[model samples]
Target: PQHAGISLLRVLLGFAVGAGAGLALGAAMGLSRRVDDHVRPLFTAIAQVPALAWIPLAMLLLGIGETLKIVVIAKAAFVPVAMNTSAGIANVPRALVEVGETFRFSPLQMLRHVVLPGAVPPIFTGLRYGLTHAWIALVSVELLASSEGLGYLLVWGRQMFWLDTVLVAMIVIGIIGFASDKLLAAVEARLQRWRTDGV
Candidate 1:
């Protein structure tokens, strides 16, 4: 139970940090065409590297500590969210944008009233992806370096030849990931209701 509670807290914290950074970067990528053109290639290249590849560097820079874990999880989360958000915003209907402009809407107003709502579905999709990625990365990081959390439990179990504990940790990770996915799916459905209701 103690391990379970700590693992749960770590997952929640990882999600919070990862999601916040991902949203900020994603929003920036989505909103700015110039920024997108400038940074997209770099972002793509960086993302192509495996998440575990960064673990050693993170350890070197941040040491075997909480920061390293958080940073890794955040990096894992950021890529998908940013990529998806950019695509979603860029794909927003030009017709709606034009309509907003015709009504003399300021850029901010246009974004808030027209672009945001149109982009929300994809944004949520990105967020869901980010969360999933973060969870995976969190487990990996914990397994590699951490002394606590569920990932640690798995590693410790393996070291002790305790298959039952390892199995339990794996199951718990799957359950949490599934729950997060479902929660995001529900939110996405709610946001997308306008599509069918014609709002």
Candidate 2:
């Protein structure tokens, strides 16, 4: 339980930073052609690299510390988020924008009434992906370099030939991942319902 808490904290902290940055970048890209042109190429290139590939470089720069783990996890969370968010916003119907303009809606009003609601579904999708990625990255980092967390428990148990402990940790990780996915799905459903119901 202590290990679970530690790992959860790491995921939450890293995810928070990643989500914030991703949303901002995605919003900018979606709203501004110039930003999209400048950033999209770099983002796509980085997204092609596997999360594990960052470990060696991150460790070199940050020395296997909590910062390294957080940075790694943030990268994992950031990509899907930024991608989905940009896609969602870019796909917002031109008809809706036209209507907003017809009504002379303020920029804030248009975003609040049209852009955000249109983007909610994909944004939630991004959240789900980002969270799963974050969890996966956290476990990987813990397994490779940490003295604690559930992933470390799995590694330690294996090293000590404690197969039962290793199995338990593996099971725990799977269960946690599944549960988080389901919870996010539920939240997405609720948000979608609210949108449909004019809430």
Candidate 3:
């Protein structure tokens, strides 16, 4: 339980950092064609690199420590979040934007009343994917470098030849990930109360 808690905390922190940055950048890109044109190409290239691919360089730069894990996890989370957010904002129905403009809404009011409602669903989607990516990167880093945490739990199981332990760790990881995703889905559903779904 303690190890699981530790892993969860780290994943949450890194996810928050990466997802927040991505959300901001994506919102900016969606709001402005100029910003999108300038940043999208660079982000596209950077997103091509996998989280594990960044591990060695991160280790050299930040050492095999918490910072390294957080940075790698951040990379894993950022791409999906950024991409989804940009898409969400861009896809906000033309009619809705027109409605807001018709009301002569201020920029802040426009975002609050129009943009948020349309964009929130995909933003949550990005968050969900970001979280999953963070989990993967966290475990990978832990397996390679950590003294403890859920991923190290797997390492310990492997070293001790404890198949049951390994199986349990894997199960725990799955349950946690699934539960988190479901929680996000539920929140999305709540926030979009006018929409109905089979879920």
How do these models rank on TM-score, best leading? Answer: 3, 2, 1
Which model scores highest in lDDT?
3
Per-residue lDDT of candidate 3, residues 48-160 (tens digit): 99999999898899999899888888889999999999999989999999999999999999998899888998899999999999999999999998998999999999999
Best by TM-score: 3
Give all TM-scores, in the order shown.
0.91, 0.94, 0.95
Q: CA lDDT of each candidate?
A: 0.84, 0.90, 0.91
Give candidates' CA RMSD values in order: 1.7, 1.6, 2.2
Query: How does candidate 3 fare on TM-score?
Result: 0.95
Residue pairs in steric clash, candidate 2? none
Sequence-dependent TM-score of model 1: 0.91
User: Of models 1 and 3, which has the larger TM-score?
Assistant: 3
Tell me the spans in candidate 2 whose CA falls farther than 4 Å from its real position: none
Candidate 1: list runs displaced more than 4 Å: none
Model 2: residue 112 alpha-carbon error in angstroms: 1.4
Itemize residue pairs with steric clashes in candidate 1. Answer: none
Model 3 residue 67 CA deviation (Å) reads 0.7
Better lDDT candidate (2, 3): 3
Decide which is better by TM-score, 2 or 3.
3
